[model samples]
Target: MIASYDALSEARKALDTPLFAGLPGDVAVSFEFFPPKSDAMMLQLWDVVQALAPLAPEFVSVTYGAGGTTRDRTHGTVARIISEARLPAAAHLTCVDATKAEVNAVAEAYWEAGVRHIVALRGDMGEPGAPFVPHPEGYQNAADLVAGLKAIAPFDISVAAYPEMHPDSASPEADIDNLKRKLDAGASRAISQFFFEPETFFRFRDRLAAAGIDAPVLPGILPVSNFAQTRKFAAACGAAIPAWMEGLFAGLDTHPAARQLVAATVAAEFCRRLYAGGVRNFHFYTLNRAELSYAICHLLGVRPKAAAAIQEKAA
Candidate 1:
């Protein structure tokens, strides 16, 4: 009877109070983007950076393509973000087909370009579903890659985490152990792969605590504006999509604007739940577009830096 009463009271409070009101914007956010391939795409990405710049993200990251295919483009993009946008930028580095000397050269170049952060990974093979074969002379895994980066320079490193168990892992425990190895090696934090339900992250957080790992793990938030495409990718990465989400997006193919609204609402609620569960940092997979991420950040009480400052002053 007590549990029932408490549930009812909580439901009533949710109904009476606006969901996003009084949030105080005490959260740190980071965004991830892929390197642009062409001149036109470069311009589009610049606009995206401009749009989200006012929010003053903790840092922005550019992804390294599979097999280190986009090395040059990634460097160019990260350098531009640092020199032009004046934002702290992190370059993604991988141990795939690159020898130790080659990888170190890239890291040295980034250090010369004023980049002080890196997202290190044991990237996938060039072809999907193919087993990852480390180069004959390259670092064996992400842990080794992290150590190598530290040996070269003091890069603030962030490694990937798989809340849903990475597709390549033998089991959940093994996955957590691998994450521990990375953190133990030299990574400062882990940025989790995107998952739909808030409980997914909550459960992973519990597991991490139980495993005696306490480093900050930023929840990766992917707002699903393109449900079908997201579903396909999620399947590849071992992320589960809730059935209710399919029902929510079920006939919105022709309704782009409405789909975006639904996407923002879902992602914002997910972030809000994480916040209630003691999550104070969020990492967004921006997919090179700013609208959905921008909207969700706004709902979470994150505003332009200047506006947020003024509001705090008034209060």
Candidate 2:
């Protein structure tokens, strides 16, 4: 029987409802951070790292900027997480502006620093809204980067997927094919760009299973901290801003506290639905902030736990 729209919406609401009691106390999570550019920002970054470190994520990643602009800083940050913080660090490596040898050298450095994971990307160049050109000497794209990383070390590689087709992707089918290539080239997992609707991610998961690609495509969740900024970014990233969401954030331009409460509630709702859909792993684009992500993790049955003293101990 075809479920009525009203019925499905009600079912989804029930599925999304948070259980403040008996929260499961276990879920796998990962966080992404960017290398700090200034001393003040570095202090804030470490403060956030210390706050979220107690949650004991499966691993934490530091993002590399477009065209490898933050390459050295990213290496230093991830290496510090490994050497000092006692956490497993994933360094993001991009196929942009650097040759295959340079990318390999970075990977080798990460390995030498005791890092075991890499978030590989075929990054955008020029500017945020400008055209992307593959570097003349670099690996052409993420798939090639993934293949090269595997050849360099037995790294746990993760690549990006877009639930809404990537702007540059030829088609949904081609995007899936690209993802498959990355996986076949030895990527162990795929982390999707953030989206609002759980059904968009669920549908993508169903299609991937149908295509016989069984690697875990983790649902990426971003807790909205600023409505206007989020709307702008979602538009750029090809994610839909649901009308319902818009209505809730309608007129709180100056009301920061209410905005945060509303953001936390909405993110928790989105995640509960995903958890009900059998998603056990989540990657959060934390925006270098923590409260909202921490709250959503709470709703997902994850709690603040001590950091793993040794990498293998947590593994």
lDDT, each prediction: 0.90, 0.86
Error of 1 at 225 (Å): 1.7
What does candidate 2's lDDT look like per residue over 176-223, in tens digits? 999999999999999999999999998999889888999998888889
> Model 2 off-target regions past 4 Å?
1-20, 307-315
Taking every candidate in turn, the Cα RMSD to the unseen true structure, in Å, is 4.2, 3.4
Question: Which regions of candidate 1 deviate over 4 angstroms?
Answer: 1-16, 307-315
lDDT of 2: 0.86
Candidate no. 2 TM-score: 0.92
lDDT by residue (1-315, candidate 1, tens digit) is: 975686565456545788777778899889999999999999999999989888888889999988789999999999998887888889999999999999999999999999999999999986768898899999999999999999999999999999999999999999999999999999999999999998999899999999999999999999897988999889888899998999999999999999999998889889977776667899999999999999889988898887454334212
What does candidate 2 score in Cα RMSD to the true structure?
3.4
lDDT of 1: 0.90
Error of 2 at 288 (Å): 0.5
